[model samples]
Target: MIKDELRRGIIHENPILVLALGLCPSLAVSTSLQNGFGMGMAATFVLACSNVIISSMRRIIPDKVRIPCFIVVIAAFVTMVQLIMKAYLPALDKQLGIFVPLIVVNCIILGRAEAFASKNSISKSLVDGIVIGLGFTFSLCILSIIREILGSNKLLGLKFFPGYEPMTIFILAPGGFFTIAFVMAVVRYLGNRRKGA
Candidate 1:
């Protein structure tokens, strides 16, 4: 049922935290809440639109060439978001930088198209896309929250722990690695425990 797919997308098969599909942007843009939210929005838009398109054209698309078609559709959506963000959300557009364009290569988008959208109805595919996208967003936001808080001693630019010296390294590339890995471990461990029970 749709509910099952939705649940799986968020936790059982989480794009960022569990499956580790879109780590590049998850790490790169998660230094701040604004950047994390922007990246999540862009990715969600692309995933939702692309899933619908792919579901509609599923029967016509040849399996051998489906990968390229999915990429084209995903890229088109990505470009649309990039243009809109550049014009409207210029600050976030600048913060995301090359990663926005690089979203075309994100495995989560293509994986969904191949794994779900191609076989499911348009509505189901759309829901799956949104659920999975939100899951990815949730993971990124959690990681960014921790990184932003510890690295800068602030949450959404408000200093929460006054007098606490921020760990400057947590905002850097190495910090992203550690933060994501640690978060992934926790998610995986919890998921396994739940499954075992």
Candidate 2:
């Protein structure tokens, strides 16, 4: 049962590819593997910590002000992650830039608080957060990999095909848009088939 919650986050309620939440980071920071990893990890840390804290405080939080409370909690954690990244991983910090701060508004974090963490046990909420965070991370990584390989003809800055010309478009902002859109379409198609079968 606990494992199922984690699985649901990755596939059923996927923050990016499925629910279409957090697309800003999904498209923006995915230009390189390092950027994607940094954004993903930062998001994961925020999501997991926020969920645990919110789940623990659910009963005491007034319904009318719950949204504000969740934002405060999420922002605090996002700031902490931002500082840690800046201090420990300066290069990645530079690569991610504004997206790190923007994690405060990433819908996946607040959505979990309102949809899952508020009602679930602390342990379950923690698992859900981890799973969802990983799902988002994996989705960005895969999309970046596809774009980088096809658009740049390189992986991690080492040329995979030195002889071939890079597509260039895959590395541009427009490429990111179409790549994710295409991937999401494929995911929805497969999801529908699975349900039908």
Candidate 3:
């Protein structure tokens, strides 16, 4: 059961590719591998921590104010993550900028909180957070790699080909859209093929 839940998040229901949640960060911070990775880790930490707390306190949280409660919990975690990042990873923190604080409103985190965490056991919710966080991180990494490589002819800030001209568009807003569209198309194609099989 646990294995199935984990697989579902990573493959069957990826937060970005499959579910299409949290696209703002997906497109913005994905300009580089480091940015994507740092953002992912920070969001993952919040997600996991929030899930555990929310799940454990599910009964005490009144249904009428559940949404507000969730926001407060998520925001607390986001603030902690932001402070920690600022302290230890200031460079990456600056690169991510507003996106770090924006994690408080990330649909993926809230969605999981309401849909799974509030109704499930602490152990299950924890697993859900970890798996879903991994899925989001994986998607960000893939998008970042494609954009960085094509847009700058570099990977992790290392030049791939000194003489090659990079397509600057791939790192811009349009590039993010194009990359997402291409990936979604490929994912759809693979899903169709799997269904047919």
The 10-residue segment with the lowest total lDDT in model 3: 91-100
What TM-scores do the predictions have?
Answer: 0.88, 0.89, 0.92
Candidate 3, residues 1-197: lDDT per residue as tens digits?
Answer: 87897789888989999899999878888999988887888788788889999999999999999999999988987888788889998887788767878798799999999999999999989989999998899899999999999999999999987798999999998999999989988998999999999
Query: Alpha-carbon error at 124 in model 2, in Å?
Result: 1.2
Instruction: Give the candidate number with the greatest TM-score.
Output: 3
Which rank order by TM-score, best down to worst? 3, 2, 1
Model 1: clashing residue pairs? none
Better of 1 and 3 by TM-score: 3
Q: What is the C-alpha lDDT of each candidate?
A: 0.87, 0.86, 0.91
lDDT: which is higher, 2 or 3? Answer: 3
Off by over 4 Å in 1: 1-3, 87-99
